[model samples]
Structure formats: C-alpha cells, structure tokens
Target chain A: MTAVADAGLDLRQIEQFLYREARYADEHDYDAWEALWTDDALYWVPAGDDAADPRSQVSVIYDNRNRIATRLKQLRTGKRYSQSPPSNLRRVISNVEILGTEGSDTVVGANFVLVESRTRGMEIWAGRVTYKLRVVDGEIRLAYKKVSLVNKDQPLPTLAFLI
Target chain B: MDCVTATVPQAGTDRPDYSALIQPERVHGSLYTDPRIFAEELERIWYRTWVYVGHESEVPQPGDYVRKNIGPQDLVMTRDREGQVHLLVNRCAHRANLVCEDERGNSNSFRCPYHGWTFRNNGELLGYPYHQGYGGRGKLNLGMATVPRVESYRGFVFGSFAEDGPTLTEHLGAAAGEIDRLCRLSPEGEVELNAGWLKHRTRANWKLLAENETDGYHPQFVHGSIFSVTGSPIGALYSEKSTAVTRDLGNGHSENDLRPEFRRHGEPMRWFGTTPDRVPDYVAKMRQAYGDEAEQILVEGAPHVMIFPNLFIAEIQVFVIQPLSVDECVQHSTAVQLKGAPELNRRMISQSIGSVGPAGMLLADDTEMYERNQVGAEQLRPEWLEIRRGMHRERVDERGLRVGTATDETGMRGFWSHYKTLMEDDK
Candidate 1:
C-alpha cells in the first residue's frame, strides 16, 4: 500500500515486532504479552459484523487497559476453567501491511490462522487483525488492536485464549 | 449411491415411561443422553410449547426481520407492510431452500435462489418463474408455512407451531411478572435488544443450560474464580446467610430471586454497585414514570428469570438456548438496552460483555461445567441425578408457587416435574 511508503517506518522492524507479539500470545507469556501494550491500550474483538460500533453493538471481547489487566489476572489465577488446562495454541501471522499513520502511531493490518487443540477437540480460527503501533521510549507498543473474525457472527466455542 | 442402514436393538417399543424416568427426587441420567428422548422433546416441548422467537423490538419497523430456530426448524420473524409480525417457516414453497439466507436484513420479500419462488415477508406466495410448467400458482398445494399462533406479552414474542393450545399469556402465567420487572426498571417501561447477540456454543445438552440458568447453588462453586478476583458483593446473595429465595414459578419457569436481599439493603443499583449520580437521569425518569414505587424498582433492579423451555432473562441480557443435537446447544446472549436510559444502558452493555458470553470471565467457567456434565452423563454406574435439594423444606407460597432457599435444587425439581408432564401427556 502507498501508505507504507508515506509512513517511512521500517517494515522489517514492524514484522519482527509482530512475530514476537504472536509468540508471546501463543505461548501464554502473560508478562511479555501485557508489557507490549501502551497504557492507553484498547483491545477489541467485535461480534456479529466487523462494522458494528462497540459503543452500540456488543462485542465478543472489548477491553480497555484496566480490563486487559483484569483478563490477564484471571488467567494468572490458574482457575479460569475455560483455560484451566490451557489449550495448546499456535498462530500464523502473515499479510502484514503498514496501512497508514496517525499522529505518533502507525496502523498495520495482517491475516492470521490460529489452531487451538484441547482435550475436547481441535478448532481452526482465522481472522484479520488491525493494529495501531506506537513508539514510546524507543520501544514499539500496541496502542490499539481490533480483530475481525471470519465467523464472528456465528455461534462459536470458548475463546479464552488471546486472539 | 447405495447406502447401508443398520438397526440397533433397544428395550421398550413404546416411549420410555417418563413418570418412572423423571421421579420427584431423582431423574434418569439417560434423559440427557438418549437420542430418542431428545427427539420426543423436540416435538412436545419445542414445537408445541410457546417458545420465545424474538423480541418485537428486534423488528420495530416494516421490512425488518431476524432468523431464529425452534428445535431444528428454521424460521424468519418479519414485520410486514401492515406492521404485523409474522413467523414464516424459512423453506421455499417450491424447492425447500431457505427463503431468507441472511441472519438479518431489511427486505419486503424473500426470493428463493433454487427455483425463483418468491414470498412476501408475511408468508404469502408472490409468484414463481416459468409458472406455465406447473398448473397456475392457485392450485399448487404449497406456500411458506407460518406458525399457527404468534403472540407478544410486553414485546416478548413467542410462537407455537400447534394452532390451538394455551394462549401465550396462559403459558406465561405468573412468570410474566418477572418479565414485567425487567421492563419496569426501564424509564419508558420497555427494553430494546439492539445489541447483536454473542452466541456461545456449548457441547452439552440444552437442558443443562436451562437448568443451570436458575440454579443459584452453582454460582459460588462454578464461578469461584470470578468471585476470587472481583470480590463481588453479588456472590453473597447465594450464600446460606442471605435471604434470597428460589421459586418454582409454575409451568416450568423458575427464578433465582435476589429481591429479598437487595430490598433488605434498601439502596438502589445494589445489584451491580452503581451510585445514583452515575444514572441520575434514569433514576429521575424512572421516578417520574413509576411515582413513589420507583424506590423499590430501583432497589430490586432487573430480574434473573428463565421462562420454560428457551428464554432466560439473565438480569440485563436476553438469553436464549437453541438446541442443535442432544449433546450440543448454543447460548445466544444480547445485552438489553433500556428504552430511555442511555447512561445506564452503556454501562449495562459493557457489564454484560464482561460477565457472560463464550469468552466472558464468569460464563466460561459455567460452560466448562456444562461440557463436563455431558461427559459424565455417559457413565453407567450411577443412573439417577439427585436434584431434590430442598424438597424437605420447600413450601408453597401464597401464589401457589413452590419456594426454596437460594442454594436449593428447587429450580431443577420444578423443571423436571414440568418436563415429565409435557413429555408424558398425549395432548
């Protein structure tokens, strides 16, 4: 996209950050995962259609900074049965593009396919992720992230793991 | 293609004796596992009973419609040009394909993709292409079939496939009071379900979700993780000390009533711990609409009631359980938006997302129990589920509804007795 050229950000740096972020999430490294977010982080997974506003329409998961902390805290307790005996997870992140830039943040988009295996069965999850990356103290942080699942509107199983 | 079919040997040629299977103190475990029993319930309970379809608020305007399911039968709930709500069986009149494919949309009519058979939103046949091939449309013995009766009580729509049976109001009986409580909390005396549903698929019998909806006993144990984190005051309501009671609101409906505990506090919004300043407009509007009774309305808040086979008013959300197979079901939840309270509605929506749904902090644990129960149901050694928690102490209230303590199995026993009646009756 022309926005990538206009943004003048290092594409290789962005890709490395995304790969590291994916690793932290797949491995359930809560500390590393939470550290990657900026203080004003907004993590969202919209339900039904992608365009439904969070302020109006319900979401599968919509967490501000405090909610993000609470979610990780719940998982840390080791009793969130949905993830008690956590499922084995591996996610492939690809199709990375620096969509554009706003203020000090760079907007990037990517496609992901995640395979989650548990005692019940295996589930194949695919979606598109939009991320707003910001640089603070020379370290890249996730300011905002929204996941638009292909099957967002359908009745789905437990998604306690980080998407 | 050649298909090989096999017949399995079973005991009784007739239906299983529901009276023996669903005893007063215990129920046979196979009711949760037997495919035959599930098939029977699909007819007697799902199709015959007045099952919740969708809210009238969901289709307020003409051309608005939403797709729903009762048992496995697909339906389209639509508002016609005359503003009458109709429940149309989604099959095409000509080829049996779904007439409306989208989950929801605005369309005056539905056109079938297979054979170009069109249907008005109200289930009337519009016309078909190449009509000369089949004698004119007047003689074709097919049209989109609508449920015989569709009725609404305060905007909650329910449909029964059987033409003549108990009126929706009769089926609701005293249970409608619970729905009224939820709506009366709204300043405008109405509730809107505009928030799109976040459906959570559960690998368990649909009855499990239904029973668990009002089982106040399980929350302290099933959702202990949430209590440990939030130190929720609401958790105290289910304890032995609290005065909250569970009711067998006749006709299979039941409730985990928290009013006694909340009213004891004599404060408003104690259900969710909000201050008056947070929802001043709502409080004021409610006071204006309800007069002096607003104090009790604010104190009691919304209800935690589940209506018979399908609908559950889960406090602030409209929850529906759609059964797919005997061991699989989906719980659809949409946050209820009050008609005139924007401030309270926003907070309720966020709270609904955090508490329920598939990934919710609280419900995920409950879902785990539901799935585990399914796995346990297959065991052969223990054939009965003991659900007579409060039978010894339960009492009939002034309204004739049986009542038990908060942490009793009164809700489940009530549910099963009602189920047995419907399953065993020929009518």
Candidate 2:
C-alpha cells in the first residue's frame, strides 16, 4: 500500500465511472451493471452504523459474486415481485475522494443521496459508499462496494432495488 | 400523563358485533379497519389471553431487562435477583411516566425521570426523591404493578393482564409441540436468542401477518423470484397435494406442514441457507448427538407454526407481531440458534437474514402485498374478504384437528372462529 497524490489519479474519470455505475443500476441495466464488477466482487450493505463483520452480524446485503449473479438473474426474469415494477431511482454522488492504493487497487469514498419512487411512495436514501476499484484491461472495475445507509440502525422499509 | 387510562368507546354508536363480522367462510373488511373493534380486541383478546412477552434468554442474567408491548400496554420484562423473571408495567406508580424508555439494558432499578420515583428491578418501590413531602397524608402504595399473570413454558414467557384464565399450557395446547420441536432441535435441548434481531414495520393489519404466515397460496406468487434464484424445492413441495398440508392445531394455532415424508422421517428441510456441502457435516453432528434419532431431528423440514395472537415460529426465526394501530403493525424477527451447533447456527442466521429484513427478497414482496391488501380492504365495495379456498375439502382428522390441503384456508377459518368467540365473549 502506498499513499498516492491526488494529482496522480484521474478524479473526474473516477467520478464519471461511479456515476455511470449508479445510472446503470438505476435504469435496471442488469448486464451493464454486472459487467462493472470484478469476478471476485463483494457487494455489501451493513445493517448498522459501525462497519460490521458480515459473517458475525446480520447484514442487509452481503453477497459474493455468485450470489450477486444469481440475484441479477432473478431480477432479469421479470418475476421478482418486489421489483417487478422497478423503483424509479436517481442518485447524486458527491464527496468523491481517492483515499489511497492497495497493491493494484485504488480505494475511493463518496457520499450518495438516492431518491427512489415506487408504488408505496417516494423515499430518500442517503448513504456512504467505499469502493475498492481495480483497473482491469484499462477499465476500472469494482472489486468491493460497501454501503453504509444513514438509517441503517432503524427499522427499514423494503429495499428491493440496489442502493 | 396517565398511562393506564381506559379507552371508552364513543356513546350512542352501535358497536358492531364481531359475530356478524366474522362468518365461517368469510370475514368483513371492517375487521381489519374499525378502530372500535381494534380497541375491543386489545381488551378482550390480547389482555385476556397469554401474550408472549420475551424469551428467557433475552433477560438471562439478573438485572437484564427488555421493554415489550402487549396490545396497548407497555411492559418491561426483567430478570431480578434470585433469577425470577417478572413483567412490570412500564409506567411509574406516581404520575405514570415511563420508568424505562430504552429498548433493552441491564439495570439495578428503574428511576423515573419525572418526579424521581424509583423501583427495583423486580418492581418493588425503592423510594422517591422527596418522600417526606407525602407525610402520611396520602396512602402512596407506589410500587410498579406486575401483570396479573406471567408464566413461562420452555423459556418462552407470556403474560396475561386478566386475573384468571387458562394456564399457559392449556392455552398453548397442541401448539406446544411446535416450541418443543424447536427446542429439541438443539443437542442441549435448548435454544438461545443471544444473536441480534431485525425489526420491520408493515402498513397492514396485524391479523394479515398471522394469516399470511400459514397461507400456502401466496408463496408461489409472492416469493417466486426467490425460488427461481435459489432453486429451492419449496415451490414444488408446496404445489404437490400429498406433500404439503395446513393443520388447525386447535385453539387458533395453525401450522403449514411442508414435505410430510421428510417430516415423518424427522429430517425436515426447513433449515434456511443450508447448502449441500454443509448438510453432511451438520447431519453428522446431529447423528453424533442424538444417534439414529438425529435423522428426524436434523433433516426434517421446519413447519411454519403460528401461535395465536402474537407469536410465529417460522423454522429459523421467531417472529412476534405487535399491533400499533388498526392498520399498522411491527414485526420483530429473532434468529433461532441451536445451543451447541455453531456451524448450523451460522447457516441459520444467514438464511434468516436472506429471507427477512428490509432487503430480503421474499419478505419485501410479502410486505408489499400486506400493504396492498390493507389499502384494498379500505374500499367499501367488497365488504367481505373470502377465506373459503379449501372449505369444501377441509376435514377433521382422528386427533380432532381440522386439516386441509396446502393452499387451503383452514388455518384462517380456525383463527377467525377463535377470534369471533373471544370478541363476542361478554366476560
């Protein structure tokens, strides 16, 4: 691990990649969203404020690559009742920063406010996201994505769509 | 503010008789919406019957306590010195302010924030800040009042506000077998609730959750995506006529029995998140503990048991439904872990989370349906919601319990019958 100067990384490009990822997920572009992740990706949304060990504490979403793939397949089938009429989602990702680098992976952090509209009503979902990004074949791919919801500690409503 | 104020129905309004609302084959929509009926239910059913408060494990040590609500009453379930469990009214004996507002904690005594009235963990009044001010003027018997009846069966504690009624065992009836089976699954013949729980609120009537727990028809539609993804045999097993059955276990308790052959062998497949690789090891451990009987204990499918009024033992999770209002309820789901099986417990926790919580694939759909059903029930056009799916096919078994096919409404009918009796009771 080495401390990298901000000037050394393409912040705009990274933000663009993050924005595209959010857009793909919002639009239910399953294949495109799936392609953005590495084969060994970890998608997680911890249940509480403090980061929790998924193996020990309960998590909202703690899926490995295989489980994520399975979930995508289910959503693609157009029969997932929770998301049959997919949530209308729009996210504003801000506070993007390059924390450092771990070997070939770049650590990035950002704050997100996602507005989701569904049958029941519209809800505002705010969260912090930490990503472990690795450049594979000159394209950035997500090795890990961790979401810490603002209201994670409280009893939550249905979160059918990906945050 | 007085917390123990009684809710008196408005005068001159004809209180709709529940007997007219709940027929054998159908129930009126007002059963899910009327505030007066809801208030009556709290008084008649919830207070009179044994409502589950908390598991003993939640307050295992002396001084440990958890706040619980039964109907409209707020209570604190505590384990005092000498290991006796007590359910005390949360309101202070003085001005009726809440003594303990936190969800749960360990405390020697509860000190009321307003007016400094204090009570011991066992609910004995310790003292007030300025007790001399009373000065033999007013007879202040300020000890916190315990619920009239509190009893525990196999570590599950229940309380009744009524002074007299059926014993906890008599009330549990055949449903006691469900709790026993859950306990016997553990090698130590004990289950613990040390792991954290998930709480979710649904915009639906509390009764809807009870009915949905044993409703076999909705899973195919509501949870189809989960089945499609996990490739679980639940979809097929539920559809097979000979495999799945819903039984009115009597006294309003009902169970949806899945995979009867496996259940008969005692190797029920109800363990959530059980992968093929984990099965051999888990089954081996069970064999090591219970010998040949382990096959039945370890491999049997978990039956979804709905104990009337509040508790639902859904295989890997214990769900308690709390009614907040006529059309709102909160569901608390605690993952069940076997006392000695760490690996199996881990799988159970994972599976419980997978199928429940806000992000759960199955529960999210069910919650949506509950809300939709509540909204639909508000419409006056369809005054009745039918519960006659398998009425013609229902039959009484040798045990005198009513039984029907998996997709039948036998369980709902049983529930409504008991509900009508309780609601119509003059006592």
Candidate 3:
C-alpha cells in the first residue's frame, strides 16, 4: 500500500478502536476496554487546564493498566457506592488531528465530548484528546491517551466516568 | 454608621442570641440557606479570620501573581520585583475595577483592563494613560490600598481582611501545630504547592465540606463501597474501634482522627506497594526517601482535619472552600509536594491525590452524600446530620484535640462551637 493509503488506513483503524472503546465504556464492558490497551498502557485524565504532565500537578485520573483494572474491578464488585447506579456515558470523538509521530509512536489528536447521564442528570464534558499509539502485532495499542478537559479549572462534581 | 457598627458582632463576647441559630451538635438550616446569614458570615467570620491566600510557590518568581476571593472580596496575591509577596485588593482605587483578569501569571505590574491605570506588583502607584490629565494628583490620590496585612507560615501564605484582627499566627492558633507537623515530616521543613489545582463546583453548602473534613462518622457509611473495594476494613486505621472521634483542640480548632481500629485492624502488608494492583513506583520511592520508620509515620496522619471555615488541610493536601451561592460551593484542591523530597515522593503524592481529588473515589462518595444532605435539609424538618460520635470522652492533651477514633464526631462539635462563638460574639 502507498504511504498515503497506509496512513489513511491506520487512522481509520484507530478511529474504529476508539469507537469500540467508547461503546464498551458506555455499555460498561470494561473487559473489551482493557483489551484495547498494551499491558504497559497509560490512561490519564488531566485535572487542570495545562496538565501536560501528571508527575508535577494533580491529575483527574492517572491510571496504568493495573490501576485501571483495579478501578474496574472495584466498580464491578458492587463495592463502589459512587457507582451504585452506574454512570451512563456516551462519548463522541471528532475533529481528528494527525499531529505526526515521534519515535515508534504515532501521535494522533482528536476532540472528544463525553455526555454522562447519572441518576442526577446528564453532564457534558468537552476536551482535546492526544493519543500516543504503537502497533503491536499489526494491532494498534494505546501507549498514552491524554485528555485535557475544557472545564478542568472549574469546580466539578465527582467525575466518575473516564473521558 | 453606628447601627451598622453595632450590628457587627464580636466573637465570644456580648454573645448574640445564637441559641436559636445553632444547637449543641446541629445548626439551623438558615446557616446554610439564608443569604442574610451568609452575608453576616462573610463580614463577621470569613473576613476577620486569617484565610489562606495562596502558597509562596504559586508566585515563586518576581511578578508571578495569583488571584483569590476571600468572602466577597477579590484579591490579587502577587510577588513583587524585590521578591516580597503582597496580597492586595484587586479593585482599582479609582473606579473599583479588577486589576487582573487571568487567574495566574508573571506580570511586572497590573494594569486595569477597563482603563489603562497601572499599579506595581507591590501595589505602588504607577503611571496612568491620562497621567498628564491627572496632573499632580497621581501619587497623592492613586496610591494603592494594601490588604491590611499579609503573612507567611512556612511556605503557606494567608491574608487578613481586617486591620485590627489578631495576627495570622494568633488566628492559626492550635491549627499551626498541624501545619508544622506536615512540614516537619519533610526533612527540609518546607512544602511547595504543585503547579495548578483541581477546581470544581459542588451543589452543596461550603460549610458541609468544612464539617465533613472533621466528620469521621460518615466515611465508612458514606464511603461504604470505597471501603469495600479497597478490601481493607476501616477498623485498621483507627486505634480505637469506635466509629469515629471528634475532638475539640480548643481555640476553634478540632481533630476528627479516624481511629485505625475503625478500619480492618492489622491488615498485613497495608503499604501501597504490597497491594495486588500495580503499585505506583512513586510509592516505593517515597518509602525509600523516608526510610521504613518515616514511611510509617507519614501514613499515620488523622485523615481529615479542617482549620475552621474555609481552609481544609488533610494529608499534605490543602483545599479552600469558597461559597459560590446558597446551594453551591467551589472547592480548590491544591496538591502539595514536600520540597527537597525525592521525585518518587511527589509521584506518590499524585497517586494519593487520585483517591481524594474531584475524580477520586473517596471524594465522589463524599460529594454525593453532601448533595443528598443538602437536598434532604431543604424539607425544613427537625432532622439533624448526626455528629454525636465519641461524645463520652472528655480528655484532652498536647495532641491538643483528643479523639476516640478517626470516625468520631468531635470535629463537628468543635466546628459548631466555634461557629456559634463567631456568630454570637456581640463585639
């Protein structure tokens, strides 16, 4: 395949992966969501506006694969009262920006708006998504999925759902 | 002016008839819902108290500035060119417009966005756009009014609104020991706030959080699922098997030390590293930096303590609760990292942050409970949020406030007693 077609194919595959992940999250199919990541994958939801790094400042959620599994396990075991009713979430990923790559990882960016419906009501969150993806056995795996929320600085209710 | 002056009450003196406003354990709903009482609190308590402005690290460099709101007043906490920190009123002396719009940044001086009137970082009079038009009335008329007094305890900075109130140290009182304890844990004896904070709004009264900080009785029940998920029982954290202990530390300070016994006692391998989950490498790093003993000491802090009214400092983290309206409050949770500590310690700080932040499982439960309380209180019944845990113990010592356990309600009683004193003081 030509390089252009190859890039197009890779982007399409990544989009499909994100769509699948969102479906699993909304449906609470955390097992499928777990499969989308490399064993060493990182999922970060930045707390503040300029949260480029979680090492220094507070992050909304900074979970490695293990921590994520723990969180999912906790949520599934009916032990997390915060998830008593279970938050219903729907995520829309658009405005795909292919910001090129840096050493072994394909850097792709997109805009995501997540709508979470709880017993209270629906909360809409918009943010920029930066994905660092690497191909493992011809399947794209998430190295890092960094979400910089638009209302990061604004006081938020408990952000139970992942963006 | 005399009537208005008379209305401004003194604390713990000529006490107003606040018996109707507050009870021994519970306060009237008007304390949270009434705008008039809220205004009185703004004028009498929040304004007079030594409120935390910001950290020195927030404005580490000269010209670095951060904006804060104390009660209804807007303030600009800035570092001057000479490295002196100043908490100046954001209102321009001329037209009362805010001088800075951005929350934080490095600025040599502040220029009113509405007009081009500029003031130095130290709130000194600077040139105006119409300087020639103002003629000789520049320095004499335009000198910036400073915020009465600004002081620093360790690296934590605070501002006082009144010119006659007690010094920041005096206002801090027994609470200073807790801050010092947190600072002393670090070998360098200094702590710096990490970059930005997690600012989020809650649909509940601000005082609810202040009460919750010192409230030990609610955690196990409110955070039932979180406790269950963590696998370790609450009985482990408290020394006493009591539900929770709230202790009056005297001088408006209190400790709601959740007793280790309240948690599942003696859960072996309780260290963050030993958990089945992927241990954050930062946790191991923190353990190494402090050595085994230091690590143990660090983990032993009484989980929740509030420094009256707005400042709630727990577990090396500081959260400022600002009342936005009767039904809502905005909380700013700033992550504090021990200066000169190992990088892993800072990372562990972040890991610990995950449990209490706006998105943390613990806070999520707390916030949900608070909303429920707020909604429940709207019915105007005789219902009271029970804070009567550990009422039997009356002993007090150098720990200042003594608690039955971490889950006792002594903290609430301490907070309410002070609240009543402040509300009733007919000074």
Candidate 4:
C-alpha cells in the first residue's frame, strides 16, 4: 500500500462509493459487494446500541469470511425460512462523518434507515452504521461494517434480506 | 364470570377432585379465555409458585441491575458490592415511580427521577436530597422499604411477592432435577448469562405460549416452514409420536415429558448438538474427563423441560415468558454458557441462540402460529381447541403422574388440571 496526500476520501468519493454499493445491491450484484471487502473482512450488525465488542453481546449478523459464505448460500437457497416469499428492502444512508483514524483502519460513521416490506407489513429500521475501511491496492476495502439498530432488542418480524 | 359461581374443591393434602371440572377428553372452555379465570390464576397459581427471574450472571458486578417482570409485577434483580443478588419491586415507595429506567446497567445507586429518593445496590435506602424539609430531621426516612423475597437455585433467580409463597426449592420439585442436570454439563456446575436478553413482543395471550412450549404436538405443523428449510424432520414430528408422559410436582408444578418415538432409540433430533465443527475439542476433552456414556448423553440434546407456569428451561438456554396483558406477551431469551467448556463450544452454544432469539429462524416460524392461534381462537368456538389426541391411554399412577402418548394433549391436560385448580380458587 502506498501513502498519498488526501486519498480522495472527500465527500464526493465516499458518497459515490455508498451510492454505487446500494445500487449494486438493488441490482442483486452481490459480487460487487463482495469485491468491496478485503479477504478478511468483518461484517457485523449489532444487537443493541453499543458494539464495543461483538464477543460479549448478541449480534444480528456477525460474519467472518466463512460465515459470510454460509449466509450468502442461505440467501440463495430456495428454502430459507424467512424468505419463502422473499422480501424487498430499501436502505437510505445519510449523515456520513469521518471519525478520525485508528492505525491502519480508517473509521467512517453514518446513519441509515432501512424500509423493509413483505407479506407481513412495512417496518422502518433506523440505525447508526460504522465502516472501518482499509486502503488496499489503490482502492478502499471494507475491514469491518458495524450497524447498531435502534430497536435491536425488540422482537422483530424477520430478517429476510441484507439491510 | 365472577369467582362465586366458579368455586370448586380446593387443592388439598388429598388428591384434588377435578372430576367435575376436568374431563378425561375435554375441559370447559372458560379456562382458556376468561379474565376472571386469569385473575384467579394470578392469585392462587403464579404468585404461589416459584416464578423464575433473571439469571444471577446477568448482574455479575456490584450495583448491576436488570429489570424483569414476574407474572404481573415489574421487578429489578440487582447484585450488590458483595456479589449477592436481590430481587426488589421496581416501584419507588413514594409515588411508585420505577427506579431503573434502562433495561440493564451498572450504577452506583438507584435514584428516583421524580423525587430524590436514593437506594443502594442491595436495595437499602440511602438518603433523600432535601432531608431538612421534613421536620429538620437528620437522615429522616433512611430505612429501606420492604423488598420482595429473593432466592437462587443453580444461578436461576426467583422472587415471591407474597411472604408465605413456597420456597424456591419446594416449588421446583421434579423440575429441580432438570435444572441441576443442565448445570452439571458445565465443569463448574454453573452457567452464566452472557449479555442483555433478546426480547420479542407478540400479539397473543401469554398462557397460550406457556402451553405451546411444552406441547410436543405443534412443532411438526406449526414450525413446518422452519423445518422445510433448516434441515430434515425428526421422527418425533409425526402424529404417531404423541405418547405423553406427565409428571406431577406437587405445589402447583408439573412437567410434560413427551415420549416421542425417537427417545426410545436414544436419539431425539431436537436434542442433537450440531456444532459448527463436529469434532469439538471440548467434546473430546469431556470424553477424556468424563467417560463416553456421560459425554454422549450430556452432549446429545434430549429432553425439553418447562417449569410450571412461565419458567421455560431446556438444555441450551432459559426463556421467561412475561405476560404484558391478556392480549400481549413479551419473551426474554437468555443463553447459558457452560463455565469450563472450550471457547468454540461456548460459541456453538451461543450460536444456538440464533435458533431461539428474536431473529431465530425457528422462533420466527413458531411466533406466526401463536399470533394466528390467538386471533383465530378469539373468533372460533372454544371447543375447536379440543386437545384429545391420545385420550384413551391416560393412566394415573401412585405418584399422581399421568402417562399417555407423546403427541397427545396429555401434557396440556396436565397443565390445565393445575390451571383449573388456580382458576377455581377465588371463583
């Protein structure tokens, strides 16, 4: 990895990256989403307000490489319990802020409100998302993506999609 | 609908005469939907029993408190500086304001937001902010208000609102053996709650859930969607598996042991421990520490035990079903991690939480059935819930335990037999 002055992490680049990622997900291009992560990427959706560590608390989606692969297989499986009829979701990401840096991990924070609907009804899930990105091969790769849902402790209807 | 007309023989030293109330094949529908019945249930049943509260591990440190609801009351289970647990009513003595607003946390002391009434972790009153206003008294009203009676058995904490309620051990008779068996799986013979609970609010009466949990008949039909996905079905998921074995624990407690056919083969599919890695280091080590038969039986998931009323415990976790009202219920799920198990084994047990927690695939399926049942039962006739699957095989023994087919409604009948006793009390 080469160091450079202002690696284009300004508002435009970050905004474009998020918009492109969301568009790719909407188009069902999971390959593009997979490419955004490093080989040892970590994806975590925390169970509550605090996510200082995933080891102590319950997490909605805690994925290492192996777990991510298993989850992706389940999503595509025809018999996934919650997705028998499939669910539609739209994630609105906003209020992006750069929360300084931690060694090699560049911490970025944002707010997200995901609107999901299925045969049940519509539910609005709001949360704070933190992305720890690492610069690799002149591209930003996700080291970790953590989301703290507002109603994490509540008994939700289901999680049929990747929000 | 009042208690006057509902009066029946009281449960006594002699066997209860439920002949008029409970029939071998059917029971009066009043037991299911009546508010008068539910109120009497609160008085003579749930209050008299040793209802389980939060696990001791939830409040591990001093000044740590977690809010919980035991039957109809809200309580706070706290651990003081000496690492002793206390279950106190959440309401403040003055104006009855709840002391701890957050679900769980560690604090120096609990101070009422309305007034400045403060209390120590052990539930002792500290002092009020404006003490001089009350007759210029020094440390006036510093004594603590009455707290609920608290007790613990195998890290499971329980509270009794009434002074004369049965002791925790006495209330948990035969079920006590089940709890002890679960704790013994850990090398230290203890387990701890790792984190805050996973809570779910469902639009269904709480009693329905308590019955459904031990009723071995509903899983094949109700959880069909979950089974359709996760894995293959177990042999016990058939209608023919309805042999119900009911154990009678005196003092209003009973256990429904479903003798599903697979149990005879020493392999209950629901009881199988599916670890991410089949050859777990702990299992191997446990084989070395404790012999093969001990390892096989303990490791293999078998019996599902539900303590009478609302304390639901099984091999892996403990769930407390708190009824918010007649039409609403909230379930708190806590996963118990064995103390000396290998790290991955603990993680595997924790992963089992995924199958039961708020986002649990299996729970999502079961909840739909409960919601549908609640809504449908309200509209349909009560007899529609006729639980007479294996009515002819019931045999009452010397222990007062009833034996029947596993898939039979005998377990449910056993529960209602106790339920009828409670409902008939005040009525």
> Whose TM-score is greatest here?
1
Off by over 4 Å in 1: A1-8, B1-13, B137-141
lDDT of all predictions: 0.87, 0.81, 0.69, 0.64
Candidates arranged by DockQ, highest first:
1, 2, 3, 4
Looking at candidate 4 chain A, the ten consecutive residues that score lowest on lDDT are A1-10
Q: Is candidate 2 or candidate 3 better by TM-score?
A: 2
Arrange candidates by TM-score, descending: 1, 2, 3, 4
Better of 1 and 2 by TM-score: 1
Per-prediction DockQ: 0.75, 0.55, 0.49, 0.22
- Pick out the ten consecutive residues of candidate 1 chain A with the lowest summed lDDT: A1-10
Choose the strongest candidate by DockQ. 1
- Candidate 4 local distance difference test against the native: 0.64
DockQ of 4: 0.22
Of the two candidates 2 and 4, the one with more favorable DockQ, higher being better, is: 2
Q: C-alpha displacement of B192 in model 4, angstroms?
A: 1.7
Q: How far in Å is the alpha carbon of B392 misplaced in model 2?
A: 1.9
Residues forming the 10-long window of minimal summed lDDT in candidate 1 chain B: B1-10
TM-score of chain B of each: 0.96, 0.92, 0.84, 0.83
Candidate 1 lDDT over B337-366, as tens digits, reads: 989999888888898888888789988888
Put the candidates in lDDT order, highest first.
Answer: 1, 2, 3, 4
TM-scores, all candidates, are 0.96, 0.90, 0.85, 0.78
